[model samples]
Target: MIVIYGIKQQLTPIKAELSDVIHQCMQEVLGFPEDKRAHRFIPMEKEDFYYPGGRSEAYTVIEINMMAGRKVETQKKLIYTLFERIEEKIGILPIDIEITIKEQQSYQWGFRGMTGDEVNDLKYKVNV
Candidate 1:
């Protein structure tokens, strides 16, 4: 699963479009197959966010966290695709985006009270 959180000053006509653009980039990067991609958007006010040494003028930061299933080639492709989309949609010539990937075993994550075993078994049973 891939999770995305977009933080920008209160949503405006333009900023709102940015949120959608970011989400689309994420979905494409993860190869969501037109479905099964989950994401969340967290918007903040300009005054409420502090970038430290980062600038706020038409700048954005994108962070991605996911398991190691995706190949390095796929990861690079996703990042490039995201930057291309951002440039096209937001018109921000110089934007900053960062992504991080990690490897996680299936047992480490669970849904409801079931672990990976139960979920995989259920899917296998259904397919059979």
Candidate 2:
């Protein structure tokens, strides 16, 4: 799953486009399947969302959750891909984008009433 957080004023108008951009990056760099999109948007008020210096209201936080199997290089590619694609396609600058990938062992991931390792078929590669 990918969770996105940003000020409502900035993210509300472009949520769908931002989701598409993020998914494009994931599919290109992480080999995510087209049908496996899990995205959550958390749009907060200005008072509820605080950012650091040099970042405007466009600041966004993207948290990616997944099983731990992909190589470091692959993960790096995904981050850079998101940064580039989001800036190019969504008009969000790199400085305003904060992305973090949270990975756990396959045994820790529960889906389809079973853990990731217990699943028999996956449409995409986890080790990519």
- Highest TM-score among the candidates is held by which one? 2
> Which residue pairs does candidate 1 place in steric collision?
none
Q: Model 1, range 15-118, lDDT digits (tens) per residue?
A: 55665775676555654444444444455666655553664444455556544466777777777877787678776544444445455655666766876544
TM-score of each prediction: 0.63, 0.98
Q: Cα lDDT of all candidates, in order?
A: 0.54, 0.93
Task: List candidate 1 segments past 4 Å from native.
Answer: 1-7, 10-29, 52-54, 116-118, 121-128
- Give the number of the best model, judged by lDDT: 2
Q: Which lDDT tens digits does candidate 2 get at residues 13-114?
A: 999999999888888888778998999999999999989999989999999999999999999989998999998898899999999999999999999999
**Count of backbone clashes, every candidate in sequence:** 0, 0
**Candidate 1 accuracy as lDDT:** 0.54
